[model samples]
Target: MRVTTTHQLYTARLPNGGAAVMDVRSGRGQWQHLNSTAALLWNQVIEGADLSKAANRLTATLAAQGAEEAVVRADLAALVSHLRALGLLAASPAPAPDPAPMHVREVLPAHTRLSLPDRAAGLLALATALFLLRCTPIRAAIAAARLVARLPLRPAAPERADQLFAAVRRVRSAWPGRAACLEESLACSFAAALRGRAVTWVIGARTAPAGAHAWNETHGNQVIGQDPEDRIWPYAPALRVRHGRNK
Candidate 1:
């Protein structure tokens, strides 16, 4: 026979004063609110007790104070139903066992340089597209855009990184060209590169004497080469990740 053990739950402080309890067995997607009484019961349940034992303990305490056991039982039953719906509880033939804690590194992927247009214009266009996508308020749209932005540009695939790079370089080198033309070309290039990936490009000054630099990042979280936090910017918001070398 298979024996089940009660899974351990963890709590976190929400932005508000209330606490949020997450069921480890169900992943971060499963969360619930915990009041003082409910918290006490949850703790008891984690200590190798069954849900029925926890409910009885609560009922007993309430009954000792001249409370109605029937009402308490009803309330506990309702609470259990809600928790089960939220994936915080599970029933099996044997006592449930606690799951081993997962490490952040185990879940996160290793960093690498994405294949992108060799030309600067293509990268700029991709960045602009990402910025526009992030501006939208709809969560699903925003999430989809972000995912696309994070995808690394693969020159080996359908896109030619060299041609794109040359185009961008020409535009950037032509210092006296019309500003509008330059901006439009750059935007198009950036948008193309970022079509389905989650990535952010940083365009700004690195230091007082070194002049400006442009780079890209994944998830706007990790940069490829430079130390993201150490870099300083004089213009535009410092995009999410710090400046760094592409890995």
Candidate 2:
């Protein structure tokens, strides 16, 4: 029963000898304060102490501070339960296993013929997406791109998943140097949506060095523009960008 803080949360100790916690994800600057006992418990749990270890430590500390032994034990128990309910405690997630031999070479787009209009729009979108990702914060860039992608556009009839993938890869080739996997994936997704095809944006992770990666998957779970090595990244996604229809 080790404890851990949730995402986008900030914790700090105050001059008044208490702890303050704020939730960044809510976009509301609300804060919660913890008293001495709660703060101590929070620290112990955060430092990787198990439930039994934390409770025993707190019990001894409070008892020596002139608190009654029975009362200290009961109060600690109640505090642990309360914090757990508030999502401040949980079992640790299992780790990713060692990766097998993987071959992750970059794929070049097919030299498929395209109409002038389709080629122009995809290239333009690719340029805009690349600039945005390089210059702006990632969350804001994704939000802005998604908004544009969802806008109404009378594009050519929906293309098959593989054809759409090839078209996307072609647009991606114009991007200078090596772009982040996120940039490539989102650009492809945005372009596909413009062409009236739906592709899912996937974010995955690798554990040993703790890196995050991104790519696209079709509705049928086929990956676009990414190799099988990418498919076996081993860690779960930290984020996913879904289109309006999926929402």
Candidate 3:
């Protein structure tokens, strides 16, 4: 089987110039540390290097140490097998494509306030999302959002998307515990889905800081709830949950 690196992988640059990757799908939130050689190999594979070619190149680098080609190849193969078992490699469909260039930066929507009832509902939705995140796997929490969107309710307008996001963001602000971008975005999606708004939940990774982020967007690619000052331009979209039939 032809397996590619998982889209959920996020790189984190170490102070010592090394890098580590995290597979968010693992649900364990542990980083797989990589030395310089391993990091180079990973980047090469991500950029389309096959195992044979990668092993050959790496082995050549270790020629001074008299590393045998056969041994290096065997080690590389074992590493790949282990990574596949860790959900960091798969023979699966391609992930979400990069967003449209023109719309990418300007897609973020203007925020608006929701009614008191709606705000309360948003908080309830956030609580449910938090509980799911803590008790179930990440995939399960996302699946729950997908299920909620399938309910028989009127589709929410674009304006409602903005209001719901505002409500969710407000609710999160008052919580004593801090929520990561992943959780916050999921909560917003959960609240919107309950109100019949099918939004896109996106998770992306960027290199400089070597981190991952999550956010919500609408059919038109209009982003919701993220601050205009916080630039997501550096991120490459890794996964997307497209819920609505609309564009």
RMSD of each: 16.4, 12.8, 7.2
What does the lDDT read for residue 45 in candidate 2?
Answer: 61
Tens digits of per-residue lDDT, candidate 3, 52-142, equal 6886787787665787777777777777777678766553223235444313422224355468866876798789878888877675665
Compose the digit string of candidate 1's lDDT tens values, residues 42-91: 65665557778788988999889898999978877887888788666653
Candidate with maximal lDDT? 3
Candidate 3 has a TM-score of 0.63
- lDDT for each residue of candidate 2 in 1-247, tens digit (9 for 90 to 100): 2222223333444333445543323332224567767878766665567878889988998899899999989988898787777665653321111222222333434666766655655676577667777666454454554564455533322244445445556767765666556666776666666666555665554434344566665543445565655444443333344454211
Error of 3 at 132 (Å): 1.5
**With candidate 3 superimposed using the best TM-score fit, by how many Å does residue 193's alpha carbon deviate from the native?**
1.9
Which stretches of model 3 miss by more than 4 angstroms?
1-25, 28-99, 102-112, 152-157, 244-247
> Which residue pairs in candidate 2 have backbone atoms (N, alpha carbon, C) closer than 3 angstroms, thus clashing?
none
What is candidate 1's CA lDDT for residue 121?
A: 38
